[model samples]
Target: MLIDLSSNENPYAPSCKVAEAAIQGLEGMNRYVEPEELHMLRKALGEYCGVGTERILPGPGTGYLLERVLCGLAVGRELVVLNPAFLSCLDLAARLCKRIVRLQLKPPSFEVDWTLPASGPALVILESPNNPTGQCLISREALKSLLKNEDCLVLIDEAGYEYAGKTFMDLIPDHPNLALCRTLDKAFGLAGLRVSWLVCGDAFMKALHMENVCLCRPALRAALAALEEQRAVLEEVKGVIEERERLKAALSQLGLEVFPSEANYLLVRSPRPDLGLLLRKRGILIADLSGQWFSGYFRISIGRPEEHQALATAVEDILRTEEGFMD
Candidate 1:
């Protein structure tokens, strides 16, 4: 069996409490999710986010919320995005927006420039701790500067906030043009449930009518249980973070270029351009970003220590056989 680490998923399984809740929820599958159950979820999420229930909007996932918001607000407006952002968001912008302005983040330091040009009626979308690169690209002061333009609406995707230990949710009350998109798929070990939500500001509340949005019964139950069992989730997250550091050091020791990551994965540049293929033959699966975005670059999700050992071994073998390949 192959150890798949293409997607940035938590290597741990959901807590027992979450599993039991999902089983219990299966009993009510015949009936639609009751409004009260949805309310309970929103209320739980609001409390977890330290915001009021009115500001929270639950959905199937962050992708769904982003699509709805983009369809409603991005039409006929300039959509600004980072080049190596989430692919789905980039595709959505290409289809839904009038024009796109891609801010290309250079290597070594994938920093972002918040000083956007004065364009009328624009929508700016950014992912902090951006995908693929696994680096946080925004600052509090830079974000605040972007929000000063009343004509520009800023949407920040904090999908990896749990691992990064940073968030801008507190600014929602003050900035009418700001919104945040988050998901439980990463740190909470609930990817299969597709549980996600949006924290909307006053302007977003009026634009996206999210009152009727609902998650499936099982997903709803699992999400509630996960939120309730916060201690176990935090412990698992701590474990993953530690393993990430160890893996980064291991890969760096092998003469591979490992970039610093604030997310649950690492972006690496290998000497061999076909590193992804070489690993696949060894029954290991990792994301090769070369075809998708850059050459000789790959993204490796944090996995079990044993799995990392297997990968390191395979890489070592490749290095020995391909000596002087880069010359």
Candidate 2:
């Protein structure tokens, strides 16, 4: 059986309500998606996020919303980005922003340099439990300091929110410059549905002019159903977190250096760089970060216990074969 764990997705099935809503929404596929339906979606999302309904803008995916946010806010400004962020942010900044100033994260720990440039950039992009490294970059105090600049617009991507269980959403009401991007894809098991949102300040809401960013009718239904059954969805997130710890311990026991992660994935440094290929041959997929800044590391999405055991067995076989070659 193929166990694909490259992308960090929730392993659990979505609630029955989500499935029911998806089937129910199909009946209206012939008609154009109405405005009121989307408005209600934003309202429900607002409640879930604990922000004003007016501040939430929904799009097909977090990347789409990220593109729009960059286009709307960072187009003519100096963009300060933390390095080794989601690859798309790096790609978009180079293309869209007038000037890009990348701040390097301190090595080993991968903690961000909280010391802002003397003249802050107009935009700053941050990711919590960042991809690849799976480390949270800033502390609450550092975040407060960053927001104090007032001129800098901070876009914090909390895509791995459920696993981390810590959020700065409460900081939104006070900081006009702060915006948080969230999606149903990661923790809610709604990747196929493609619903995401940006929670921002009044100025951003006004800046975007309340554009009706298109989310398909069926996807909207799925998103709403997912929200209604958030408790169950969160329980799944808890399960992933628990399994992540167990997997980390197991990998460590096998002599792989596993990096700390607050997200639903682990950054593992394999002794053999070709380990990903060997595993892929056995129908087990993990993210090879060797091509990225992390030259010897790969990211493993948290899977069920059986998948982890399969991976461990494969690793042992590879090590034994390699030891024979050495002898």
Candidate 3:
């Protein structure tokens, strides 16, 4: 069987309670999710996030919720984003926003300067522990400075918050212009269920209507079950982090430059761009970041130990063959 490690997903299956909850939800497939059930999910999420239920706005997925936020807040405003952000978010911004100011994050560290234009209305979108690079781009002080500007609105995607062990949700109470998009898809192993929510400040709450934010029955059940099993989620995140370090070390030993990551994947650079192709030939699929943003760089999601071993072995074989061919 082919080993797929391209998507940053939880390698382990979700807790037994989550599965049973989903199965139970299937019994009422015909009816839409009740308001009380949705409220329960939001209440559970609020408790998980340390915010009030009034601040939570549930949605089908992060991407969808992001689109809504952009459409509602981005028109006629200057859109500021990182160079290598979530691709879908970039694409959506490109289409919706008239003016986009992209802040490029250079390599080795992939750090952002956190400098915005002195004045004017702008919507700044940031992904903490940014995708592909897997590094947290902004600090609390820097974010606070931006929040001080009344005309500036900030939207942050914290999809990898569970792995990164950091968050800006606490700032929401004081900053009306700040909003956060979070999801159960990443750490909670609910990607297939498409469960996501927005922790909105007063401004966002006023702009976007909450009545339209509804989730399917199974998704609602699954997310609620997953939240209840936070202990299991913590254990899973610990395992992924350990595996990530091991995989990073293995790749570095093979002479590939692996960047430090806070998420469940590693950003690696190879001498040749065909590194993805070489591994694909061995029935191992990893994300080839060459054409998307950079060349000779790839993202490998943390997976089972055996799957990682197979990837390392394939890379070694490829390198060995290349050395022989050069001779």
Candidate 4:
């Protein structure tokens, strides 16, 4: 096994029920599908997300949902984003040709500018439980500050929400300017299905141009089955959590600075960036995130036990090599 840890995904195979469900849905698949076919998904997600059906919507994945959220609100002005945020969010801002105001996340904690400027018709984007750094998510208090301003539209993409449960979805009704995007790729293990969703006030969904959102139904079907099929996904979730705790304990023993990780990955820095790259040459697939805000650093996903052990071994080998190099 190559042990693909590059994309943070649930390595466990999909439920047997999921395959049957997709096949059943396939009988009518040749026919044109209804947009309201999204209802079951919305209902299940609402139950999981604690948001109402009117407040939620689906997409091919979180990326498509995020694109629509930005397209609907993007006013051709500035879009404020955190630097070294997820790469796709950066690409979307560029595609929209929206002038970006990239801000470096300040230390003590990597946080965003909650009091973002009201200077232009700006759409603010950020990832909570943020991707590479594995830092703490922005709080509801921070969200309140942005929503209170009323001039900007705040979009929080919690792609790793499975690992970090904290979110601003409950406040959606209070802030029409607030839009939240979520995904099943991480939590539900339907990445192959490419499932994702969006939750906003009814007005936003009504105003949204939803043509592209319809194409994700095949994956959405698997996603829905995952939700309704009796806690099938939860077992894998529990496994990942257990492995995460185990990995944390092992990495801590090595004395590397493992930053607080709310997601499936750990943020680890070295005395020099070379160490991250050196481990990579050994056929290990951990993330090496050096010189991009988190220079001299890398991230490794919380994988299955066997994979975790192999990575830990590679890391130990690297450390022993480094000690020899120094001596």
Candidate 5:
């Protein structure tokens, strides 16, 4: 099916209530949007986040939220991030009125360095359960240490938190300098809607020009529906998580070095690069992480049960037949 694990998303749709609510919301299509729906979304989201609704800032997605965050912050200097980072961080930082520092992650762990710029204001960002290789976390102690050394803003992207089983949202209300951002696309299955939000301190939120509903009428409806019945959405998420664990084990059994992941993807290293290319010829698509290092590696997404089975069977067959990480 040409599964697109390249982007972290649940193939499932939002709750059944989401379809119903979307249909119901369409009935009021001719009229201007009531700020009330957005207010309701923020309320439900706040409850979900375990924070005040006023603390949550909703947007199109992480892209929009990050853009606004960089634009809104007048932190007199630049942005420093872990290189091989989610590319957008560097892309957005480029447009900002600041210097950009790209630090490569320390090998094996891929953790960022704590020695940040000690000058004026800085925006230091990191991702937990980060993209591409899906390298899980940087430890709570590391997070605390990073925050302690830099007086600047620390943004943590929690896009994959649902699969990772952790979040800093609960910490945002208490930690004035921390901002925790999340997107509905991964867990909620609302990728088409591009709905996302972040919980920051009241001071950080109040400074920006806030709007009740920033997305279009269609996306707002989807966001509300998804939030209203998050339990069902989470059920699908659990399935993805379970499948990921199974896939990880299968890869390990084959003697391939599979980088441990808390998210719904696996980074498997082969003795040679040809197996990755071979999988692509067989119509299987996964990222080639080989170029990043001198060694051979590829990342595969954990799809639905059948999709995962196909991947497992393919790997097993490859080993049983044309083994040797063939070209």
Candidate 6:
């Protein structure tokens, strides 16, 4: 079997309730999803997020909701994003915003300055535990202070929130300009369901014209079930966390520059840039990030212990066989 560690998908299967609910949802496939059913989802999402139903808006996924928010609300505003942010975020900003300001992340540390220069209405997207790099943009306290400025709208993409355990959701109560986007696709192992929610404050929610957009019946049911059994989801996350530590230690022992990550994946800089191709030849797939900001670096999602061990062995073999391969 091929070991695929490119995408940061949960290495474990979903909760049992998700499958049962999905099966139940299939029986109602003949009808279009009802509005009341979606409202129910909103309620569940609100309860889970510790926000009100009005503050929560569910859509196909975070990408869809993000596009909608930018298209509808960010027309006249400028877009400020960190370098090496999500590709989708970049595409949306370019298509929708009039002006784009990219803040270059500091090298080695790969951290961005949270403070913004004097600017007009702008939509700032912050990806915590950023993809590929796996570094968080800012801390909770810095996020709160950034929200207080009221000069721009802050969209915090907390897709990796479960791994980092740092959030600015509580600051939403006081900051009307702040909106947080979360998804079940990451930690909850529900990527195929396309279930995500955008949480906004009262004033921000009032400004936008959110529709009755909802996920499919099966996805909604499964999302609700997943939320109900969230404890089990956390348990699975705990296993991933443990595996991540083990994998990091193992990779570091191999003398590779493994970057610090608070997410499900690790960013590793190999002495051999051809390591990705070598691993792929052995039926192991990883994220080759050479074209991206991290040259000579690849991203590997923390998989099961066996998968990690296999990767370690493959790396060792490739380095041993190849000439001039530095540690």
Per-model CA lDDT versus the true structure:
0.87, 0.82, 0.86, 0.71, 0.72, 0.82
Q: RMSD for each model, in Å, please?
A: 1.6, 2.1, 1.9, 2.6, 2.8, 2.0
**lDDT-best of 2 and 3:** 3
Q: What is the C-alpha lDDT profile of model 2 across 173-256, one tens digit per residue? A: 888888998999988888988889999875567667565678888899999999998898788878888899999998888878
**lDDT computed for candidate 1:** 0.87
Query: Would you give me the overall lDDT of model 5?
Result: 0.72
What TM-score would each prediction reach against the true structure? Answer: 0.96, 0.93, 0.95, 0.89, 0.87, 0.93
Give candidate 5 misplaced runs (Cα > 4 Å).
Answer: 27-32, 133-136, 290-295, 317-327
TM-score of candidate 1 versus the correct structure, residues matched by position: 0.96
Off by over 4 Å in 3: 89-91, 117-119, 323-327
Q: How much does candidate 6 score in TM-score?
A: 0.93
Tens digit of lDDT per residue, candidate 1, span 8-28? 988888988899998899996
Candidate 6 Cα misplacement greater than 4 A, ranges: 324-327
Give candidate 6's error at residue 83 in angstroms: 2.0
lDDT of 3 at 319: 76
Model 5 TM-score relative to the real fold: 0.87
Can you tell me which runs of candidate 1 are displaced by over 4 Å? 323-327
Model 5: how far is 206 from its true place, Å? 3.9
List clashing residue pairs in candidate 3: none
RMSD of 1: 1.6
In candidate 1, the residue pairs with backbone N, CA or C atoms under 3 Å apart (3 or more residues apart, or in different chains) clash, namely 129-136
